[model samples]
Target chain A: MSGHNVVAEAFAQTQYQVGGHGKRIVQVLKDVLNEVEGTVEGDMYGSGKLIADFEAKMAEYLGKESAVFFPSGTMAQQIALRIWCDELGLKKVAYHPLSHLEIHEEAGLRELHGIESVLLGEKDRLIQLEEILNLQEEIACLLLELPQREIGGQLPSFEDLQKISAHCREKGIRLHLDGARLFEILPYYQKTAQEVCALFDSVYVSFYKGIGGIAGAILAGSAEFTKQSKVWKRRHGGDLISLYPYILTADAYFDQRIPKMGQYYEQAQELAGLYNQCPRVTTWPEVPVSNMFHVHVELPKAELEPILAAVYAETGVGLTPYVREYDESTSSFEVGIGDRYAQVPKDALHTAFRLLHEKLQNL
Target chain B: MSGHNVVAEAFAQTQYQVGGHGKRIVQVLKDVLNEVEGTVEGDMYGSGKLIADFEAKMAEYLGKESAVFFPSGTMAQQIALRIWCDELGLKKVAYHPLSHLEIHEEAGLRELHGIESVLLGEKDRLIQLEEILNLQEEIACLLLELPQREIGGQLPSFEDLQKISAHCREKGIRLHLDGARLFEILPYYQKTAQEVCALFDSVYVSFYKGIGGIAGAILAGSAEFTKQSKVWKRRHGGDLISLYPYILTADAYFDQRIPKMGQYYEQAQELAGLYNQCPRVTTWPEVPVSNMFHVHVELPKAELEPILAAVYAETGVGLTPYVREYDESTSSFEVGIGDRYAQVPKDALHTAFRLLHEKLQNL
Candidate 1:
């Protein structure tokens, strides 16, 4: 097997590991099934209590006039920007070069909506307020992703975010928050969801990410914004005849996990500290700002794979699923702490890390 | 109350109705939850056994090399047309003016993909072969909806469909089947899905419609075509982390109902005949083509609403949920027969129709 496969096998074989509770469709929806009546009508084409009530709750939580549930965050964000651009009579927007829209969606913003995206900041860091001021393009909207996920879940201080919001408002540039992990960052900021959402003209949150729902998103903004999104949603085909499966799970998990963010954030910090103590192992951000961070290893993937597999087998603790090669001499993997982290025996976890440290020293 | 609300309340009160099985989300998913294991991983970002196996089954059934599950048929059809347009180097396509793409989707094809649609025929009928031959636009594709829905479920002869297919093939134009209700029309065509699919370059089928699935669609075609669609699916954010909810229900309901189309069609015809016998009442095409037909009542909505509501109240057999005003003098409502038809007591249904006939005559 290839090195990646070997690491994956080790991760899969172990009884104890890190990450969120499993994503089994059955397990994710088990609790939700009990709460719903079999005879109750499911929402049809976005009209029914199942979806409307959840949207209302999320809208109130985010302090927006209205919110619309969407099939995916990608569709919601693209539409959010498209709405802003259409309103401003400009088909241009700005976001970080590493934003999911810029790099991950196959340039859907450009190809599907004919909207041009202006890359805002350098790849490795968050978008600085100075960068927003220096933007050469006359952009209609600016999109900022909270806890910039591609950069190891790094987050800017809340004060900086406030300044950026003020500047964008003065410039007449609509600000949209790509807050896919919005719930995860709340503990670090020590702020309510409403406080953070208040910084932008529009916001999107993913239920499947840190909340551990099956899949869905909430695009919240003004009533007019949501009404327009409904039309664009139909255009994008995001309006499923029934979105209750997503809504039900999102409601269950959001309520279950939102209050536990502080716990997960502390667990992530403790876990990252264990890795940093090991030889040749380091974590981006040095300490985690939320429930996730990236791990960089000094050894190449080919050289490091067997050692990691051996550690998992001997210690019965899986550290990472796969180590990705950055170069022939370096590799990395991401770790996100959740309910699973609490399940690992503390003694076993420490022994696994000690073994991991010894193995790296030997290398 | 408004006329529409009165009719709606009457329909809601009746225990019997003429439509498919109820779309209660829990009921639709109850059986599926039992068959799946809680530990089995849900598909993540379109990866896992749950989605893959279902896609394989659909592709095999449709006689295609591959298929992909989509969140909605609107996204699938738009992406299918975009693919053909992209491959042919022409951003133009053709379909009936009342095609879902032309009317229902807020012109997503034109707005999102920059693709132009050439309307092929009059609003009141399916596209004729002669219209295909006389197309004024050099188009990349032609979309055909079996049992054309908007025109009251009318269909041309199978021989006519074959000729249109042959001509489109010869002209180098791709043919796509908007087979939203492909299974419903099979008894009339006397062809298996494969034989019907053999005539088209691509196909999109909805699970939520006649199948009574919660919501989902399948886009099937050549391996290359499906591969391209996957990319577009991601772009459109149709790739939910787990589509197993849809996939499982679709698999169950499709198997449960595929054998019942002939039954539903017969029920529809019988139901239409009763309406045709009533004064000033007519069925579109005056015959049922599939399991669905439009009922046109030659009275102003204001006049027809109370009469129909009274019939439902007196006989406890609801013929329709609402009547749509076509004009001040005429109103229409669609009826689709499914499991519910078998539930309505025969004696009550006859009495309901007799009452409906007497009321219409009194008008």
Candidate 2:
């Protein structure tokens, strides 16, 4: 096995690990599946009580007049931008350069919708209100990922967000919130989902990220925007014969975990502090604004692999499963706090962090 | 309740109703879920053993080198056409006017990919070889829906299909088969799935249709075509965090129901004959080309609704749950034979048909 695989495998076997709600496995859906009555009718062609109720609940939670469930956030976000573009009679939208649409979707927005994107900000930071106020392109929508997940979950101040939202509104450009990790930021924002979502014209939140559902998304907005989204949903084939499998789990997990955001945020801050204590290791933002952050170590990824593996073997605590080469000499990895952190034995976590710190000092 | 709702409710309660494999409900996935080990890892980001194995299995079954699992046939079929268009460096394709892409997808093909389509055949019949021979426009792909579904599961002779395939190949136009109900037609064609699939450059099969899966589709074709589809799949957001829910049910039901296509075909022939005996009722094509056929009645839909409801009430057997208006004085309904037909008592079925015939005679 390569160094990456060796570290990942060793992390998998560690007695305790920190990150994610749980392993992404079939067992994650067991809680909801076991309660499903086989005889009860599932939604057919996107209409049924199960899906309708969940959509309604999410819409109400997000303080939107309407909402539609989608098979993936990827589809929901694209359609959201598409709807705005169509409504405004323009085929352009703008977002951060590091946005998921630019980085991950393989040019779906460009190839599928014939919509052009003006990547607005530098790759390393969140979009600023100054950038929104001076967009050179006549764009239909301005998409903002709350907590800017790509940059170590760094979030802008709420006041700056309001200013950005107002400027977009005044400019007749739709403001869309890519709130895939919206739930994780609620504790830090000190806002209800509705309060935070109210700042944007539309919101797309995910069920699989922080909420830990199997997989699903909700696009919420005005009734008109949602009505338009349905057409695009069917166009994108998001209208499956049924989505009850995703709905039931999303509903169950949303109720069980929405209240745990505060605890997860606390865990993230505590964890980041521990990593920052190490000599050569530091966290972006020096503290976490939500339930996730990034750890940067001033060591080559190749050299850091053995240290992480050995730490897992000796301390029975795994920090991260893999290291990403940040540059020639720097290594990095992302961390998301979830149910895994609370389960770790307190002393073992401290011992592991102490060893990690000592190792970083020597390096 | 409306007449449609009353008739639908009555038919749903009948113990001897035929058409479809059980109800399109949660129970259809039970057999699979009961056998799944919760701890077994599910596919993540469209990779993992489960999805890979299922795609490989489908590819082998379809006599193709590769296959991809999509959340819906809509996404898969569009992607297939798009890939072919891109491969040939043309942005145009052709299909029957009644093809799902034309009639049902809200113009996804045109709007999403900016690909124009030429409707080659009349709406009322299958695309003929003559149309393939006489191409009025240059096209990248020609999509053929085997056993044309909207016009009531009518199919041209297999010889004509081979001829059309040859014409398309000679013209350097890729042929794609929208075989959503591919398995059902196998018995009628007296051909293996591979044998039929060999006629097309790409094939899209729906597990949710005749296979009675929850909701999933396979796009099978050459290694090169299938490789390109993955990029488009991600763009369409069909690449969910995991598709194991759809995969598990599709895999299980495909195994359980594939061999029963012959039995279902036989039942369809028998049922169509009974419907043909009624005074104002007739089966399209006079006989089923597969396990499905459309029933046309000389009476208006409003008038036929009560008559069908009465037959269901009197004989405890339901002919159809809904009637679609075919014209000013004609009404129609569709039927597909499955396990439900086998469960219905023979005596009750005969009695129901007798009542139906008598009611139609009076009308």
The DockQ figures for the candidates are 0.75, 0.81
Give the Cα lDDT of each candidate: 0.89, 0.89
lDDT of 1 by residue, B111-221 (tens): 999999888889877788788888877999999998789878888888888898999889999999999989889887888999999999999999977898889999999
Interface RMSDs of the predictions, in order, are 1.4, 1.1
The CAPRI class of candidate 2 is: high
Q: Which stretches of candidate 2 lie over 4 Å from their true place?
A: A1-4, B1-4
By DockQ, the best candidate is: 2
Clashes of each: 0, 0
TM-score of each prediction:
0.98, 0.98
Q: In model 1, which regions exceed 4 Å deviation? A: A1-4, B1-4, B23-25
Give residue B162's lDDT in candidate 1 (0 to 100).
88
Query: Comparing to the true complex, what docking class would candidate 1 get?
Result: medium
